[model samples]
Target: METREKILKAAAEMIADDVTATISVRAVAARAGVSTGSLRFHFPTQRALQDEVLRRIYQHFMPNDPLRDRSLPARDRLVNCLRQMLAPAGVGEDARRAFKAAFAAFIAPDPSEQVHTAYLSYERASAGRITHWLNALDDEGAVPQRDRAKDVRFLLTVLNGLAMERALPYGDSVLQSETDTLYTAVDAILGTAAS
Candidate 1:
């Protein structure tokens, strides 16, 4: 692999392996098997290096901007997309574990600029997707005319709460409860009954 890519992958793997990883330049250099001079040459600054790594970290959880898919019913599509905001990136147990690990790092208290960058990126991406779906719903007259800004904020707030709740107990029942709660809130917001 290329030197710069190696360094980036090394840093990303560090966070994936240990959410508490320091990711200091020296440490990343050693991990990547590159010299500090080479790492600096590619990264310019630690902040820059971290920023790139953060982008990769967020990539695992953020779904393909679901706003682009229009094949299904708008409500179904919107709900599917919203669910994807917190849903596993793939199927089965490993996907869930990977998502949990990635998100744990995202949510863990970290004062680093990299964490801030990753957190804000997630917010911006998810918020943009939410706004797009809301606009589509409003256009279809499914949602009553109102402050879209407020609705977007409210919907995302609820979804973020659900996403954060995953850090709690792990089990089929716990996941089902979370899913039930999420759909309940979403149905209330979008006016659909589960039954």
Candidate 2:
């Protein structure tokens, strides 16, 4: 990768470690083995670097898959979509640490609104994917006569709620239960159309 891209990637990796941590440009430059001035030339501010990293994360989380094609059954498509969203893509200790650090930062006191906004953006991106899947299901006669958009919204809301719950304290058992319930509900929804 180019020097600028390398710098951004290093900064992203660092920020991912602790999304809310006030990371220094010098640290990023040191990580990237570039001059601090070079890092600043690429990303003038910490926020700019963070916004780019977040954007990249969002894009990776929400891929443009060909599952939307009508050739696949809606049930399969919906399941695939959900799997993509729920699957943990970040790997190894470093990435996990980054996620946890960033997560805690977002939940920390003072100027918390930005973290909330980032969360909403992530939720909406996932929701949009869900909406696409549901609409496809409707087209394939997989979702009965229900309002596809409403169903999509409800499903996304439930999914997001479950994800958040899983991230919280005292949610381990509840998270598993909620996942089971979510699958059962999904199965019922698809099964209803066949009945």
Candidate 3:
């Protein structure tokens, strides 16, 4: 890989650490086995580097649109689409780590422009996923003729609630129960036509 790519990879790996403590350029340089000056040469500003790292993390959490099989059942497809929002990183461990890390940055006392941008990007991506799934379901005649915008917001709210439940100090069974409940709610919300 090129030097820039190597630097990005190293930075992304650092962000993936369980702690997700502030990732400094010096630390990233050491991790990449590159000089601090070299890392700076590639990313002149600390915010620039942080933005890149967050971008990479968000990318890791994004799902592949082309890979989704639209031919699947509506409920199955809805589940698949909803899961994609969190599945790219992973379902459990990775999800926990990524969420803790990103949410920490987002809720920073005074978020920098870069951090704010990353947070907004995450929100948009999440909303887009839900909108995509709703459209797909609507296309299959599984959705009612209600206000789509409202439905999207509602689904997002439900998903966020479920994510919070997952983040709580609960057992795996609790998480599974919440997930199952989410799907049932999603099915009902979509007015699923599949029997």
Candidate 4:
């Protein structure tokens, strides 16, 4: 790989392993086997490097915007896409860790309003896919498509809540039970039987 790509890849891997580290330019340069000046040539500031890495991390999780598969059945595709988000393995543990650290940073003493804005932007990007899937299914006479936004919001809310719960203390069984509940609820809402 090229030096810039190598530096990014190395920093991404290290950040995934430990997001609390200094993650300095020299450290990334050493990891990329390039000079510090070379690394700085690509990223003039720490924030720039981190922001690029963060974008890369999210892209890795939902590449090619899998959520935009309007050709697929909405309910089924939404469920499948959501399942990927719930599990920590699909997105790479390191990227997940990096995101978590970034989230923590956002919620620290001096939070960024831009981060909140970014959350909505990212949500809309992913949620658009789910919403489109549902609308397409409705158009095909599969679903009634009433309150499509509400349906998508509810489903996403439940899915995200369950995933967060699963990641918290003393919530394994809660997570599993909620997952079962979600499957049942979604199946009924979509007018389908469990496969």
TM-scores for all candidates?
0.49, 0.45, 0.55, 0.48
Where does candidate 4 have its weakest 10-residue lDDT segment? 87-96
Where in model 3 is the C-alpha error above 4 Å?
A: 1-71, 88-93, 111-114, 193-195
Candidate 4, residues 1-195, lDDT tens digits: the string is 999999999898886766445468989999899998999999998857865776666567657544357676555565666676565522334445645764675555364677766566657655654555565456567676467677788777876666555544453366467657677656755877666
- Local distance difference test, each candidate: 0.70, 0.63, 0.68, 0.66
Task: Tell me the alpha-carbon RMSD of every candidate.
Answer: 11.6, 12.2, 11.8, 12.7
Lowest lDDT 10-residue stretch of candidate 3: 58-67
Kindly list the per-residue Cα lDDT of model 2 for residues 74-165, writing each as its tens digit. 65556556756655523334435545775676656465777777776665555546655565565567777776557777777666555555
Count of residue pairs whose backbone atoms collide, per candidate: 0, 3, 0, 0
Q: Please identify which of the two predictions, 2 or 3, would achieve the higher lDDT against the true structure.
A: 3
Model 3 per-residue lDDT tens digits across residues 74-144: 67767656665545444466657766875788875488887877766667656655655665556568888
Which candidate wins on lDDT? 1
Whole-model alpha-carbon lDDT for candidate 1: 0.70
Instruction: Predict model 2's lDDT versus the native.
Output: 0.63
lDDT of 4: 0.66
Report lDDT (Cα) of residue 136, candidate 2: 50
Error of 1 at 102 (Å): 5.1
